[model samples]
Target: MKLTLKIWRQNGPEEKGEMVDYQVSDISEDMSFLEMIDVLNEGIIDGSIDDKGNYGPVAFDHDCREGICGMCSMYINGEAHGPGRGVTTCQLHMREFNDGETIYIEPWRSKAFPIVKDLVTDRSSFDRIMQAGGYVSVNTSGNTQDGNAIPIPKENADWAFDAATCIGCGACVASCKNSSAMLFVSAKVTQLSLLPQGDVERNRRVKNMVKQMDEEGFGNCTNTGACEVECPKGISLKNIARMNQEYLKASFTTE
Candidate 1:
């Protein structure tokens, strides 16, 4: 298969960036999107893909390509995580496109996610929000109590588990016109707030996480619901509502 990739390239965070086109041929339909890019990068480094040697290897992020790590983030053909639903960029296969298609690839375009190089963006803003409070205050080390001791409702447990599946990929921000991270932040907030294990710090967690999200320059949600549609894990927008409730309650209760 052959593809024309119009990929975004920037030397550094402060540098001007532009889309550069390159043709990749002999790609297997079974190859994961990253593997196809590996072929292109190999040619680029070896000076075989471009006779003029103008192209350097493109830099992108990927770890545990199984779609769990959420490190492989990309804006493909103007869509977050490509055309698939509930799939990360690494899980995207070459077969999703035609043999001779022209694909546009880009990094997550958000002020919070500054460009690093090529198609890679700095997503550490998510980490800072996580550090702000996405955690349980309780210890899980020596003599941890049995998980079943709390007797949480099945519905609540299931909801918490669903929200915990978020991988912090930042696709939600990329997909949102406002570049809001409410979905990601709320998923972390809801996963903990729904259960007894996370109750001790629930109020504080929501308050601090939301505060850090705003500090990072992430926009406010306008209720457009685009974040839910593009999230690789299908993290629900209901988490956002839950987070708002948590925040509202915290504002009155916490000092």
Candidate 2:
């Protein structure tokens, strides 16, 4: 199928950007979104599509194209990861669009995720937020406690597992009107707070991560629920509620 793509192009974070249009043909419906872009880039590099000159291939982030990495983040047609539920851009298929259609693609827009180039944004802010707390302290001096030694409720274990599915894709922030990272942060918080293994630093983890989230320029969540809706992993809004509870308890108890 032939298609028109209007993709955002920027040389660097400080450089001006704009939408550039291109025409691509013979695209397979089975091709993943990133694969389709690969075809487009090939055309651009070979000077087949753009006759003016070699405009260079479009720059976008991708790793582990199986969708486990969440590096293929893109705002397509005004929706995060294109028009889909519980899927990342790498998992999105070209069949989702019709023949002769025009697709608009852009990078995640947020103060914390400044664009590094075309479709690639510096999501290291997420790495920093994770560094602030998203871990559990444990003793490893040959006296490590067995994780299975402590029996945990099935419900809590299931919830913790669900929260752990978050891939930190930033769809939660991209879809939010305020560009809030609450859903991502909350998922990380709940993933540990519900498990005994994470109990030791539960209170402190919430405090530091939330503080670092704010310092990273992420906006506050106002219960709009966009983050939950747009999350590729279907991370629940319940995690946010749990995070708030943990934060409040930590604020009062933890010095």
**Which candidate number has the best TM-score?**
2
Write model 1 residue lDDT over 50-78, tens digit each, in one string.
Answer: 72325378899999999999899889998
- At residue 111, what lDDT does model 2 achieve? 99
- Roughly what TM-score does model 2 have, to 2 decimal places? 0.98
lDDT of 2 by residue, 86-121 (tens): 899999999999999999999999999999999999
lDDT of each: 0.91, 0.93
TM-score of every prediction relative to native:
0.96, 0.98
Stretches of model 1 off by over 4 angstroms after superposition: 51-55, 140-143
Candidates in order: C-alpha RMSD to true structure: 1.5, 1.1
- Residue pairs clashing, model 1: none
